[model samples]
Target: MRNRTLILGVTALAVAVTGLAAPSFAARDKMTPEQRAERMIKRLDTNSDSKVSLDELQAHMTANFKAFDTNGDGQISADEMQAKRQAFRDARKAWQEAKSKDGKERDAALAQLKDARPAMVPGMRPKAFKRVDADGNGSLSAAEVASASEKMFKRRDKNGDGVIDAADFTKKI
Candidate 1:
């Protein structure tokens, strides 16, 4: 009789855990790569023209720079950049902590996280800005932003279609 009760308790615990984890699994499953790319394109294509132009990209990047410039100083200082990096790390740690408790699920989640790491992060922003800072001005000007945007557009528009659209994100597989 004791063994039967213990087995029921364990089964109940497993069911509760599984129930709690179901939503996260479902959410992750629903976010396909195409959906993610479309979301990004929508966000970057500010004019809703179904394509991302250099002007749109530059505007977005400039806005991001302003956001990171906590002091409204028109430049991102090392301290501001460090704060951004810390925030990113904290968020990533929280995400990892919220991942599945089951070993297999946890491993899969970690693998997915590794695969989905962004090509650019706040920590890399300073270096990226330096690359964009033409004339060694130590700061990004509007012209530099436009130039950088043009370069980025060229790189992302793999087919050289003059604009970034859904085709740029398509995989050949």
Candidate 2:
């Protein structure tokens, strides 16, 4: 009996050590341009349509804004992000209670809410025009325009390139 207990304790300690050494699931993975484009396409094609029309992209963006823009303002402030998180939690609880929905409807509703926020105000960081002009030719192509977006509530991308995925805003740092 003592031998079995010792073995169990050793196994538990090994498992605990393994868990501590395990890599985080959220760590970033390098993606090829094609892979990045595919992810962008997947996100934009919310309706599962093989192709995303301009209007569909706009609609999807609007919904996203509503979820993150808690203040109902055009931009996502820090406070607004907290509020949105709480609201999401509440909605999730309600959704769990219903159990009839797979949360698809809840997600759709949240997306629609964000879409209702005003078109991003002027002078927004990571300016939309900047993002679209990826080659600095001062022209935005349909594909280029599709991927430009805001990260957090501040950093904005004018071009949808995956190169600027880092969140660091400071140039020198």
Clashes of each: 0, 12
Q: What TM-score would candidate 1 get against the native?
A: 0.55
Best by lDDT: 1
lDDT of each: 0.70, 0.50
lDDT of 2 at 139: 39
Q: Write the per-residue lDDT of candidate 2 for residues 46-82, one digit (tens) a residue.
A: 5675444455555665666555444554545434444
Q: What root-mean-square deviation over C-alphas does model 2 reach?
A: 11.3
What TM-score would every model get versus the actual structure? Answer: 0.55, 0.31
Looking at candidate 1, the ten consecutive residues that score lowest on lDDT are 115-124
**What would the C-alpha RMSD of candidate 1 be, to one decimal place?**
10.2
lDDT by residue (1-173, candidate 1, tens digit) is 99999999999999999999999889886987778878878888888888888777777877666656668867655566667667666656745885857777667666655543333322347778567766675655545655666777798888887888889888861
Ten-residue segment with the worst summed lDDT in candidate 2? 149-158
**Runs off by more than 4 Å, candidate 1:** 1-32, 91-130, 133-145
